[model samples]
Target chain A: MNMMTGVSPWERLIRPDRVHGSLYTDPDIFEAELKNIWYRTWVYVGHESEVPNANDYVVKSIGPQSVIMTRDEQGKVNLLLNRCSHRGNQVCSFERGSARSFTCPFHSWTFANDGRLVGYAFPDGYEGQDKAQLALGRVTRVESYRGFVFGSFAADGPTLREHLGGAAETIDRLVRTSPEGEVEITAGFLKHRVKANWKFILENECDGYHPAFVHTSIFGVADSMIGKLYGGASTALTRDYGNGHTEIDLRPEFRKRDAPMSWFGTSEERLPDYTARMKAAYGDTAAREIMIDGTPHVMIFPNLFIAEIQMFVIQPLGVDDSVQHVTALQFKGAPDLNRRLRQQTMGSVGPAGFLLADDSEMYERCHRGVLARNPEWIFLGRGEKRQRQDELGFTVGHVTDEVPSRGIWTHYRNLMEPI
Target chain B: MLSRESSATLMSAITAFLYREARLQDEHQYEAWEKLWTDDGVYWVPANGADIDPERQMSIIYDNRSRIALRVRQLMTGKHFTQTPQSNLRRLISNIELMDEQPDDGDIAVASNSLIFESSLRDDTLWAARNEYRLRYVDGELRMASKKVILVNNDKAIYTLSFLV
Candidate 1:
């Protein structure tokens, strides 16, 4: 392997068809990721529904940076760094809440929900210190599309829309499945930790080849029920939607099979009621199409992933540990539909879910496997030398192909390389 | 309130029921464990806090009798990958007492604190929880109408909780 003379260690780690094992195990490489990918890219924060009211706020993260996503007095969403200007203690410690102002427990320096310095306890202690200048520090930039908010540490780069690129349709299609065209986060979230690199989860999210083998116990028991509806594992449409995003859609045959893919229940029990509800909201044709649409597992690059009715954020805690916070998105007007979605969400990905538990073990096993000294390179050449561009300009491939993994590594290498 | 002798007898009966339940799971007697539940039984492990409605909020594990049958079936099939190296577990149950009763049903609500030791592969995880059992003493049989586990570490991220807790 010839190393490019001027390339740094991180840049040299990535290859076209395979990546070095150190990329997943080295703590030094984790630091490089923070600088190259986390700080440089636009990271998703929270959804608009989370902060619908004027004072509502939720603490989020952009890489290692803690940020507060709040709706201000004038009804505009603000992404403010959680650090207190005076001595830097986190002002908002709770996960999510609604309040007019944030007060630092360390010194009681207060800032409004919009990140403006409201007041301070010892005002006279600083005679010439400008209160306005002492306001809460915010991330470099914050932007949103359709209700999903995002932030970046850099002052300038590609806008969120441009960064989303071909993946915007994925997000749009997700929220559009709602009858009211809006989705709300369920009452709470389910969080679980996996001892592995975060990218492993990202890769597993789009890979269609692993599940039937990994979750064979769960799926095997329900083979008759699942096999009838899903048709077969090979029929899914797996493709890369550019900018490192990917989707593996397996429900395209729902209508053709007369099955409602959205429901985990059998088609006979769900279609009559579920289809009728859709028809009432969107009329017969659109309703039928929407019900039949395969609920794809869409991975928006670095972290955000949505599958079925659940949305989750993967927070990287350390080199070997990452936390996944999952929220079941509920329909605005459909109570029964929301309940079913909740059931499916718990059944699939929640902490004690039938599926996520399997994936977590696999990820830990992958991390542990790479601990071996030999086998320096992890082969990723499942389906190579074949790719296509969809109308939306996303790179497309076979459902079982490793094209998504290749796309991720390619974008990852480009992002990590120093300019 | 029952007499002191009556209360002690009731406590012993419930304690034996709880211990037998744990042993059934430890020995992989899932079918035997399944038979301990009532037809309308609910098995819930609430997240964030206790008494949370599974239909209204997210849960770590929430299943009615039928769903519980499905989960148990999967575990028994030797296919759940997380359980590939099946967990070795023992529950230390303590602080058994009767909880506040529901007015309508002839069910006794039993509460206890437990420290469950689960080890698989090279990892040993200590799982702590407040176990609340809604048992109906039907025809001299103790049936699990509901079991709610409020894990002390429920708010934190957990890995491979494949075995029943």
Candidate 2:
């Protein structure tokens, strides 16, 4: 047998069937994940609508590396390392603003929006030096789909579209909800850190099983409010879309049947004159389709998540910690009252939201439990006995099952191992 | 013009109210705090320090009574996973000032500087906020119309603030 055989550390730590506890508590494994998965995959940076004009920039991170995504004077978006080429000083320290060029504070080295070396404070000492070879390092790949921008540190990975696969439809639906065919990242963001494994969040988001039990308080409140308003019972519906994507449909079911789309109050109670307003704005069917669909939440793998009413981005800070940044999106031509309603709803679902407070608390509890004794693995066998596949190559389970979380971990484990 | 005695009394009332609120929060007297707000009171924790508009700038916490009650219920629930290792907080409120009053709305705008020392099992956090309280007398009681908190480190990346700030 080989010297590094059956009892090897790698084999014992990670296997096709189970993952070791060290994956959650070990710093070394965390570092490897940062380098291999976060740096290699297409990580979401920001949205094009965030920097609508030339020279607008936003700061974000991929792993531990700080990066600035900017719209150049030529209207092309570029993602550049925030570090200065000389002495590794941070090039753009501001969180976000409109600037033609960023000047390093340490040595006064300046870089344009496209990350070109524009000017230097003092040129006497560097007369003979090669300035062309010393430009701000650019990201390997910077791509955008439906106005959402993403950057990858690796050069040889699959194209952004290929990486997204069947997930692009969700993005399309998000943008399509607006008659303008685009969405912008709204001003202001809710930034908070959760003391839990980053993967736990991604797994829990589409996990429909946790709501009925984990969010009993939310359901109670919803029952009181929803019952009073609609005189119906609220139901949480979970559907598994192929390619590691899932959707959670939360709609009130009345009279022992899924309430018709009209009862949810799209055109009747919420917007009594919605049809007339739509005709005055975008015509007839356009308004009906955009306003009526009831799907609320969508998740794009590796860290981009969206709710029809809210937008959020999750960035891994450490092995056992992650930062969740939330923004509320608004239609460009949406009325002030509609925008305020959206903002109120978004705030109710944000970090301080009734639902999120419980979710975050649960994440902390999970983190505490995982750090407990010498357990080799955490079980993901909720629906293993009934793992059924559909047309999309995805598995389905009961509304309150851990099937989606299991799928997330399965994909995560696959991406973690070397190909 | 108001007499110096009246002004001092008003200041004392404002300072006492602020201290009482902090004490209630530290003691987890959430239900009592809920009673201090008007029916339509808004609690806002601005994401940017100098933001003038809550509509345009993001806030850390913006909740009304209903949402605040919901949060209280969740915290009391056994399934609130994040609160497993419950967080303990101590707040220091000082530099109280009665800035201005709107005669038309009968609203008194009071500003105070505050520092909160929060401790979880693994981390200790320090937060400094400039708080503005818009108070109005309703039915002979001083009730808050809006409470706005602007943190000094507003624009910086932050950890989860799972409680009222």
Candidate 3:
């Protein structure tokens, strides 16, 4: 285990109570993380709804690498490296578009959206050069879980389902919230940058400890009753789903808010109609459970978070900066419900929203403070001992516990440490 | 389009109003800025396409008059920790032009560009936007009927935009 100190590097760096500051600031560690964590894990690309029609494509990135998620002529989704094989130029330029082929602007080395090299100028320039082999570098593995596409770069590892673990049921419940058992990415997305490390944003997503403090202004300034209801939610919990995923669930009363698409809570007026419809489809118990479950905030490790009808895709830019892409999801069959969802998303977590603004400021402050080098250890000792493994083998903790972040560190150490 | 002289005068008047509004924002005059809006005013900043409906699509900022006031109220309160030290701002407004007018409704539309210089603790940022404002003459005073801000960095990853720009 030891080269210099005769002890595992992670043993000293990542403890149950704390993680070293270098985990957030070291350039070499960031690179190592990209290779071991991001590259090795199953990474979400784009939802199938984003590329609904043939030839429609959207660009997605993991750290420094950009990839295209496209629906080819066959209507199957393909995840291909955006880099052109010939000159390493990005194959597709637009954010999302319907295109037959992605032509590299550098030398016009055109490849079909399916990762097939169909044509190139001066094909005989290098006679017998295998164009098929030279197609856009396809990711090692690509799979879709209910239209949510994900890709992995490593040649071998866990399958997408294996990678997801208990997070699968959470996702299943998420998409099933749609009356039609489907949802679409309708309202587009809001891309924001944070001045701190990428992990900070991910941790902040389910950090049940901060909302009461960080979003206090939101409660104070809100004119609507729903804000007050959220402000009044006294009980909360953060569940550690197996395989590094976390779910932060608030008390059932909070989900009792009388808003349409009330992921947090539902009211009596709309409950009858919603429950009636759901009962007709899945019976009373399932419908009631869904109603009571409210909105579940699920975080799929390395970087994907879905909560409150929105999805967050995080990209690490450097040791000190990260890009956060937020998309508002809409119910497929419920136009009115979709409208409400979009409005709620707009009011909450975008760049200027009541929540994200405070969080970003905190992130930057943390970044600044971490540079001090004197504090050495960042205390995560919040409710460490109270956390325990659940019946499903998950480590569960109360909302105020550092359980989620600890899970992240545990997973990070597992991935980064030598086998 | 109005006559050249009328358009010029309209531009000048609207320019002064906008500059005053910018100054109010920079000074963090929440109450005064709230007074600049018509009761039915809408403040919208589209996230994706400039023309997308803020009601049905994701927007950076979309506020009815009431919510706008509430937003300003929140920022004015010390609880909005992002502005604890209060972000320092200076805006440069240019290319003010009378783009459209609805005489019957007593409304006029103008277009302009903005470059907002913002500074906070240990950091500084420059924000650029194409601003379109619908001005309504109410009670013999021109008030903001609606403001649509098309941020230049809308498509990119941006940090906090808590303060008014």
Candidate 4:
């Protein structure tokens, strides 16, 4: 807490077992996080399927900055800052649409969907101003892995693949669920606003510890097997895949029951055509394994959450406010399954979800509780002594442990303190 | 089309039904509210836009008859923490109009505009929506065959909308 000392705040505040409460409430710390983490990392923009045709675009936010994901004439995805070069008015205002070019309403400066400044209203205003240089600002890098687009502001850093590390396989797992080996994010998102820090969502999404207590009501009313799935009785594991990524692996639990498609509460018999298609796509062995393994429950650092049946993007609005945009994951070739996915997504996520409503309340209460500042730290030491590294060198722990939280903090400290 | 006198009487009956339904929701009368629905009732609240395929697009709330029963059961459990203290709610219904065309099932189509005010956990939220309803008679009593709520801000980030819309 002493300012005279030369030690960085992260060094002083982030311990092995706990983190400072100010991480959730301090405005200065939040600002620092924006600079060190969000602005510098490969933040997910949107999936390629969102804009399938040329000139299609969707507006999204990376940290606090607005950006547009567009598909241009060549069917290539482009990420450009929404700011117009003329006077900084946001060029595209609509959430999603198709337009070959964006014209700034203030001065009528137009730019192509691929970030080219094409025209302006008046000719006498400027003679030698370089139109090429005046194009809409773009991220330093934009990369895609399995159609998931990510943009970064920092020009010099680890490549998106390097940043994804072991988490790339998690994304692959999500895409692999499709019979055609591709996923479509065409279903519109459900944005859930919460009165809490963004980190709470990052941690809670893959926490694996709060379900039995925080969601007992839902489990009780629905007779959900989630309690047994993550209640120290199942064989599920929580993993920290380094680089701020984490996962709650339920494959082991599903495999133990030998119930294929049980993760979705359905069986192969219920979806005969889907079953046939899966086998035809990947053969019997791989398809059976894929069905048993199911979709992933993973947090891909700084922003993206590939939850089992859906995808969530956590955008931080302020120190104590955030919005989670959620969408149901749809497969490329499975119509029957896609419908079920939509229904299940309605049942479990979003602002009015049966399960997430309670979670949002808890987040608000946690933010309010942390604001008290009576307790200087939030404990995260569960299973720290017993967590082990799997064959992939990723840290693994019990389903009821704080392995994911500790993982997030460890990588967070590394980034905030850069060395 | 019905005669003017019959239309007036039907309008009065429909108005009464809507008011009673609104009161039951505001009072948290879960049992009574559940009873207002026919055996095959459908409740839908579409997201992003009102004209969408619920089976293809994500919805805020889409419940078939069985799911409706499950939803009411969940609300009544008293353990659904989101509604633990329950929201203090009041809604005003206006601009009720009988739509043209009676369906083959003897259901009357009605449309109305509403504004709901909910005060909970020291936070206040105002919700505005246009509602469409299909009403039919079952056992000599009026019942809801289907209800669709289209919120004005369906495309924006929504806070906890745990209560019935």
DockQ of each: 0.75, 0.53, 0.78, 0.76
Q: What fraction of the real A-B contacts shows up in model 3?
A: 0.87
User: Whose TM-score is greatest here?
Assistant: 4
List, residue by residue over A1-419, the lDDT tens digit for candidate 1. Answer: 22657656645567777888988989988998899888778888888888889999988887667889999989989999999998999999888889899999998889999899888886898888888898898877888887888888888788999998978877666665676766787568888888888988889888877766787788887653443333344455678776788787656545456555433454524545545566778887776566667354788878888876788888887888888889787766656677778887777776678889888888889988898968788888876766677676767666767878988888888787766
Query: Over the stretch A140-248, how does candidate 4's per-residue lDDT look in tens digits?
Result: 8999999999988898999999999999999888887899999999888998988889998899988888898888877887879878887877678999988999999
> Candidate 4 docking: what grade?
medium
Residue A311 of model 4 has an lDDT of 93
Worst 10 residues of 4 chain B by lDDT: B99-108
**Judged by lDDT, which candidate is best?**
4
Q: Score every model by TM-score.
A: 0.94, 0.88, 0.94, 0.98
Model 1's DockQ score: 0.75
Considering summed lDDT, which 10 consecutive residues are worst modelled in model 3 chain B? B97-106
Cα lDDT for residue A196, candidate 4: 88
Against the true structure, candidate 1 reaches a TM-score of 0.94
Q: Candidates 3 and 4: which is better by TM-score?
A: 4
User: lDDT values of the candidates?
Assistant: 0.80, 0.70, 0.80, 0.90
State in Å the error of residue A382, model 3.
Answer: 1.3
